[model samples]
Target chain A: MSEWWTYRPSDFLLFVPRTYYRLLEHYGAGAWPWQVAALAAGLAVLVALVRGRPGALRLALALLGAGWIAVAWLFLWGRLASIAWSADYAAPAFVAQGALMIVLAALPLRAVDVSKPRRLGASALVASALAYPLLAPAMGRPWAAAEVLLLFPDPTAIATLGLLALLPAGRRAALMIAPLGWCAFQGMTLWTMGAPEAGVLLGAATVALLLPLGRTVRRRRDRAARDRPPASPGA
Target chain B: MPTTLDRRTVAAGFLAGGAAAALPRVARAQAPAPLAKTIPSTEEKIPAVGLGTWITFNVGDDADLRKDCVAVMAAFFEAGGRMIDSSPMYGSAQAVVGAGLEALGSPKPLFAAEKVWTSSDGPAQIEATRKLWGVPRFDLLQVHNLLSWEAHLDTLFAMKDAGKLRYVGVTTSEGRRHGELEKIMAAKPLDFVQLTYNPVDREAEQRLLPLARERGIAVIVNRPFQQGDLTARLEGQPLPALAEPLGATSWAQLILKFIVSHPAVTSAIPATSRVDHVRENLAAAAGPLPDEPTRTKIAAEIVKL
Candidate 1:
């Protein structure tokens, strides 16, 4: 038999793009009105995160965690597994991510950072809620097929990255792992199917991955400035 | 003698008469009887066109899509086509095909062609695949993509020797591993060999086709449309005037004709979900096939497009 590396991305994708989009449409149809609830829940979570109270952070984590579990059940297992066999394997990862979030929610809330990174994260969360659903319509698919925040994995993962950004840099990286991994897998799936929507997950993942590096750079610069002797006062 | 008026005789008479009456209606719904080709090993004749279940029938547990697949299968059988090919690797396709066969009342003419894909546990996997198809025995079971062919071929030949299978074969697709495939075709006592062969992808025409002819191994052509890419590419182009003589109305039929016209090809399995496309594919087997010069013209025309 041929080696595994000889295969291309297209080889792994069993169905066509239309079939994939139809799967989303079927999922949307089955989980109707809940999509609206999901969008509202996402907005509520974003609001809670922006407020940055200890209880509010817990509430945001709890909500995002529950949303991840729901998407795994409704979309990944219930709908996607019907078409893509790997969805069964993928659903457990989603469940694990959900479990992780809930566990984190029970922990003590650390100091929140209301910096540029946090603002960027907030913008991403807003996009997940408001702009994500419009992507289906933008791509000429029916609105019924729109991928709503907290209702689908992509937007939910992006929203998680957003909320993670609001936490201290040290606490954020470990939590970012699951959502970033999901983004890569989902992005590759869509990319292989030739769907331009892959960019949404990939772009969010790239930015989320780089945010900590950017934060570390700014911290090192600040520390150097603070430790530097008598900033030329003698001169 | 007076006809029997007993309940058993009366019921038997009604069933026989009803089946006789319903047979022609099913026949009339399809095109003319599909063309048949001879299997050199046993001289058994099968339709030149067959149904393929690669991506088309992988709709897992979806009742609506399963119904669609049943409709396609029903159309295929009504058209007198057999030799439905599938593999375990095609997601839920084997289950979908099983469901379709059950839904169609397990048509008697079904030529269940399956594959052994796993690197180990060939017998167990074949049994599982048999359960999936809901058939007593497969007409043919092949080593899928030549995976562990040495072991699986031994199992398959053993089954054939034990009368558990009617034929033994091996398969490859997308023109991959043709060298190894060629070596096996030359060495093994294979009843059938399937590979990708379309108008555009005619690499098999040079070696494998002639080798199959020499070895008396039947050729089952898969991806006759390059998994629908070739047809999609030729969609808007006009069928050459020569296609009129072959009674090909669509590009799918024209392309199928081009594949099966070769003397070495025993059957071409074109996978499709649409009812009309299945009928059209089977229809290509009907009427006159293209001659060699015409086959070249068909290939040339598709390339020019």
Candidate 2:
């Protein structure tokens, strides 16, 4: 193995930014109207997530699982691996994430209280996945380069994080491990390429991470409020 | 007493020798004769500027991009470049290069150089690489970045001994592992050694270059523009007045001219995706090279930048 320190981040950026965008364009061309299907799926998952019933939650989870599997096979393995060797290694993780989500969907799980904060965070993620295609036009790339939900990893990973965020704190953190890691990897890759999309991914990751922390802190405050003695009225 | 050769046999032998000598010369005369440096071990010459398929040729199965890569390769060969270096570590680059060669009708002058990066089954990897490039055998095979160097070198040397391989070498980039590279160069009978060397990344000059000369191992300079960082940095800057004397119009050509001008450097591989850039890079191998003093000034000017 090479001495690790000898490598800089840019050394790993094998393809240029234009090459990367072209890859997206290529994938988008091959997988058309599927973007429409993915967006519809994202909306269905959002409604199910907002409904906060175990059955609806399971449907949402199943949709996310199917999305992950599709991205793992079609995008990561079939497309990204063509240009980046490391995509082969990351593809398996996406498969595992999909498998785990599918398994979780089958399990008899309770829907966590869909509090206002949880709903907002979860909605943002699904919305982000659906809105991600806008980045193509925003970045001056043609619609052919749009990163669609379930058609690309970034949106899929981000959307998965948003879905998992709907769970109770303990289980939510546990389920987020893979998609969070993927976000970091993809974010670093885009950052190294000097692509502006890094901001979107990294920002989503930050919100995903802090969503749990914010809930935990709020829970602690509620617990303290219940445990403490009542204060003197108007004192 | 020695047996006399038959008249028919002598005539056939003469004809074979004449055809072998005449073909390459005829081809060379069609293009500008880029400066060539001889391999110390074999006395065979290769053009001083070679094409590097790092990120440039990793276009995968995109038909348009593959066609573009072929155009770049066509331009490179048209400019008299022969040696094209690539590694399996560069994703899909070997396959893309194969596509380019096939599209170009497999140019006769291709000096196919590839690196074996796997730790086990070196021969298996080499065979797979051969099928990818559609070549009978590689002109040179290198142990990439010194990974499993001991085992790979033994395999390469064995292949050379068996006449299945023409040359054996090892590569390291970004000036990493020079101490170990020097050790390998001193101990093994290497025909070529590829390492990162440019005006700015001159760490190779202190020992590796001199050691290559002493050991009679031909040096192939990689990252001749620090993988385009040097050129990008020096892009808007003025080309040193010395560049005109050396016939370098662009900074990329000037940097290439500087890299290849070193007495120890046999060839400098500059990777580029653009066909025009490949032509510009190959042009550096032609015309007058910068003198020692001019090279120093060029380096100093770059350092200042």
Candidate 3:
């Protein structure tokens, strides 16, 4: 019966920028209202995913995805972020973050099994890691503390790994730990370099790491086939 | 000899004279005047003058009336003129222009310029503009009157990188924000800037025009007659004899030629609701532009009018 029930995720994404502008103008520096709205939307998406309503989840993801992109774009090009940094610096950072969010949101994360969510999460993590180097050309700044501070870990990867680790031990120990270990290695690398380019190098390294794991999976499959008893004659 | 001067000879002479009389008419139909410049966007070399469909398109009967408007547009284009400037705030002008283009068989327009008005609607607005014009990419897009300009610039830059837009610009009219417009021209990398500049409103000549020249930004003049205000002022006045040297047949051509003569001005868009007016505007693009002394004399004459 409420208008909010009929709202779609895409609409929410578009609506957020307009709402953010008004709220930012009204509250100015107090961005709590925007953060709360974003959190609520994220919660709704989580609920939809748990309920197996893929359509709802997608729409919700799209909304938050586009909304975040719009916000980043505004900060990059509009008055808010332009006040703090030069247009040249602010704009590229906004573009990089917005592009990362859109790609993450559009990814088919819902299709991955909860039993093996870490694989998909790791892939996203690697993809975002590699995206940094490509973004450097646009940023046009030498790697500095301020530039390095802009590279934040993919939040979706963090959320997915956290959920997977909380599952039963057998699933957690075998499936979740591998991705967690990889992420830890990546985190360590990022800590040492403290530059955006390092994030890209770490991502490239993950792809190299996945190659050996793929071969192990293939060998295990072959071994399992050899051990299986020959099919009995029709009895 | 006496026999040759008889009825047959008289008939032959009459036919030859008729053919000679009809030759000029055929030549006039065959070769329309050559355009001043060919916009690199298309094969057609467009005349330097064009129509700006802002306020006039809004006052029309309805969107469907654009069918008639297409004829007005066709008159301009068919006469070797191109370029049409519109904005979203101009109500259904973009849609009407789109319709007109479709009705006219979608001839390759020399230049299509539109603007994004709202900060939040920048991307959608650009997308909508592309769709409305049925153009693969717009030749030029400006931030209308500096409204939400920064937001529009972001979308524009992305579009430009993707080759969805060829050029980006900003505009101001009525000489209201010359200061702000000048600042943007100085700070931002722009291809063009639209503003009001006529003999009547010479404020832009002092700074904005010179700055555009220095910056290499093309200028598109709008409200050249102050939306008919200058024409009203010169209503009863006869054409000055000095305009003859510039090949300006009427006050319209004289005024337009003056604006287009400026090195910074790429083109001038003066809107008209009638086909005759479009023809009159197009005539300014026919001959060589006014020189410095000629321009000064034209300005002095306008003061007298």
Q: How many backbone clashes does candidate 1 have?
A: 0
Full-model lDDT, candidate 1: 0.82
Per residue, candidate 2 scores C-alpha lDDT tens digits across B1-305 of 11112323323332443322222111222345689888899988888999999988888777778767766776677677889999988889999888667655667778999999964999999999989999988889999999999999999999999988899999999988999999999999999999999889999999999999998999999988887778878878887777787888998888888889899999999898887787778777888898899999989989999
Which residue pairs clash in candidate 2?
none
Runs off by more than 4 Å, candidate 2: A220-235, B1-31
In order, the TM-score of chain B in each prediction is: 0.91, 0.89, 0.84
The predictions' CA RMSDs to the true structure, in order, are: 5.7, 6.7, 24.9
Assign candidate 3 its CAPRI class: incorrect
Question: lDDT (CA) for every model shown?
Answer: 0.82, 0.83, 0.58
- What ordering of candidates by TM-score runs from best to worst? 2, 1, 3
What would the per-residue lDDT of candidate 1 be over residues A32-79, giving only the tens digit for each residue?
A: 989888888888877776677778878888898998898889888888
Candidate 1 per-residue lDDT, tens place, B1-305, comes to 11112323322432443332322122243367778888999989989999999888877766567667776776777777888999988888899888777655666778999999974899999999999999999999999989999999999999999999999999988888889999999999999999999888899999999999999999999988877778878888888899898888988888888888899999999988878788888889987899999999999999888
Reference-based lDDT, residue A28, model 1? 86
User: Model 2 Cα displacement at A186 (Å)?
Assistant: 1.3
Residue pairs of candidate 3 with colliding backbone atoms: B38-B45
